[model samples]
Each structure stands twice: as structure tokens, then as C-alpha cells.
Target: MFLMMGLMYFVVDLAAILLLSACWQRTRIRGFAIVAASYGAGIVARWTAPLAYRWADSGDGGMGSLAGVVVQTAFFLVAVVAVVGFWDIYRVLKQRPAA
Candidate 1:
């Protein structure tokens, strides 16, 4: 069961990486920097999510639980995607030639 879960996580992560890379080129961002920056920010957010849960839980039963970690990771991923995706679309439009 653990193996399957790990596999699923790997597959999903791979898909996300591909999606981000493919989408990066079309942006006026001009370099891989934005992708790297966004990914780094996401990682930091995920790492910090436990603190969020702890605060919400009033200092008890923090993200010490498996479910909490998963929730935090998912939230971080979504937030990163939203912020980065929006910037990417904006960049794409800016880079497009006048028509």
C-alpha cells in the first residue's frame, strides 16, 4: 500500500513538473528563473504548512498527523500553481506579437 502511494505521488509530481516546464516556454518571463522561483516558493510553503496547522489547532496536534501534512502539501501546491499560472498567462500575452 505504501509503495502504491509513493508511486502515485511520483506520477503526479512528474506530471506537475512536465506541465510547469511545458507552460514555462510560452511565457514572456524570458527564462527558467520564474519556474525555479515559483517551485522554490512552493517548497518553502509546504515546509511551513505544519506551522499553519499548528496555529489553527491552537498549538495542539499540529501537522504532526499524516493527514495534516497531506493537507498542507496540497494547499501549498495549489497556491503555487495559482500564483505562477496567473503570471505565466500574463507573460504569454505580453510576449505575443501584435495582431
Candidate 2:
């Protein structure tokens, strides 16, 4: 179940990275590129969470829980960065001169 959920998130994150990369390439917006990279990191962190959970349930015990916490914290931080990047992109777009 957790694995399936992680896979879903991975797919969504992959798509987001691709779209943001394309947007960045077209617009040359640093924020979009940063957000896309953050999303890439997010995919890794997100995938780690469930595996850590599974390990915690098995025998890894405290270490597994700690790993899970660390990964989740990283995921949250990446999400925050992505939000800030989006805000920067929005500001840039708003400041653009009309064509």
C-alpha cells in the first residue's frame, strides 16, 4: 500500500520535473529550474519514506524511524523551497513588460 502511494507520488513528481524543466528552458526562469530540481530531490525523499516505514515495522527499529523522520523533514523543506520558487516565478511573470 505504502509502496503504491510512493510510486504514485514518484510519477507525479517526475511529470512536474519535466514540465517545470520545459518551462524553465523556454522562459529561462531560474525559479522554475530551481523548483524542478527541488522536485527531483523531493522524488527521492518521498520514495525513501515508505521504505523507511517498512524497515521500521520490520527490525531496523529506531534507525528506521529516524530515517523516516529525516526523509519527511527533507520532503517538507523541499516543498517549502518549491513554493518559494513558484512565488518568485509568479513575481517575475507579473513584472514582465507586455508584448
Candidate 3:
């Protein structure tokens, strides 16, 4: 079951990336890496979201509220964006015209 879930996540993530790429202009490899990382993080968070909710009320760690899930998701998105944006900028710089 766990393996199936992992495979599904990978497939869904890859499909999403491919769909996005169809409308966007970027290197396939870079897009794949960014999307894969982001999707993996999302999958992990979603898989653990329920646990987060359950533990949030445990009143022990810093994640002592349902808000933890939201925070985690936001953090994951930010990380993905940062990585993708940095790579895009690098690509742009690398393609700059010679002075």
C-alpha cells in the first residue's frame, strides 16, 4: 500500500510538471527537478497532514495546533519557488549576450 501510494504521488507529480511545461518555456530537466522536489514535499506533507492535526493538540512540540500543516505546506511551496526561481535566473544569466 505504501509503495503504491509513493508511486501514485510520483506519477501525479510528474504529470503535473509535464502539463505545466506544455504551457511554459523552460529546460525540461530543471522543470523536472523543481517539480519533483516540490511534489515530493507536498506528498510528504499531505501524507502526514492527518498526523499533524492529531499531534497538534498534543500540546508538546512547537506544532501544537492545526496551523502546523498550513505552515508546512507554505514552507514547502516557498522552497520550491526559491529553487525554481534561482535556477531560472541562472539560466537567464548564462544566456546573456556577450558585451
Candidate 4:
């Protein structure tokens, strides 16, 4: 199950990069930037979001309620950014520039 989930995530990441390529073609972006943004930043940040939630409620080593609030906020921001990033990529991919 875990392996399948990981594979799905990889598929999502690649699809994001592939889709972004369409828009970047207009602005003249390097291929590496799309791959880096999609796989490195977008996917990695989305994965790390849950980790922040986990850290917010760890054992004694974890911080108090205030820290919990902060970490949860981080989690929310990361998630929001990830979603927005994907949405932006999707929007860009759908555009049809002049020939």
C-alpha cells in the first residue's frame, strides 16, 4: 500500500512538471526549473506538511500549545502553497499562446 502511494505521488509530481512545461515554453524557462519546482519544492513541501503536524504534537521534547499552534499554521501554509502551486501549473498548461 505504501509503495503504491509513493508511486502515485511520483506520478503526480511528473505530471506537474510535464504540465508546467507547456506554460514555461512561453516565458522561456529552463527545463530544470520546472522539474525542480514540481518535484523538489512542490512535492517535497506537500510531503513535509504532515511532518510539521506530527512535530507539533510530539513527546515531551515537543513544544507546548503555542508551538503546536505555530507548527499547525506552518502545516496549513505548506498545504495551501502546494495546492495553489499545482493550480497555477494547471492553469498555465491550459493556456494557448499565439502561434
Best by lDDT: 2
Q: List the residue pairs that clash in candidate 2.
A: none
Instruction: Mark the regions of model 2 whose C-alpha exceeds 4 Å error after superposition.
Output: 54-68
Candidate structures ordered by TM-score, highest first: 2, 3, 4, 1
TM-score of each: 0.40, 0.73, 0.45, 0.44
Full-model lDDT for every candidate: 0.60, 0.84, 0.64, 0.61
List candidate 3 stretches off by more than 4 Å: 1-11, 17-28, 60-63, 66-70, 73-99
Q: Write the per-residue lDDT of candidate 4 for residues 1-99, one digit (tens) a residue.
A: 976897798787778667666656665544434444645555665566567667766857555576667656765665565566656555655674747
Residue clash pairs of candidate 4: none
Model 3 error, position 80 (Å): 3.7
The total number of steric clashes, by the backbone 3 Å criterion, in model 1 comes to: 0
Weakest 10 consecutive residues of candidate 1 by summed lDDT: 27-36
Error of 3 at 52 (Å): 1.2
lDDT computed for candidate 3:
0.64
Q: Per-residue lDDT of 1-99 in model 1, one digit per residue for the tens?
A: 956875675566556666666666654353334554555455556556656666657745553565576676776676666676567767777778989
Best by TM-score: 2
Cα lDDT for residue 27, candidate 3: 42
Each candidate's number of clashing pairs is 0, 0, 0, 0
> What are the per-residue Cα lDDT tens digits for candidate 2 across 1-99?
977987888889899999999999999988999899899888777666667777777874667768767777888899898988889898998999988
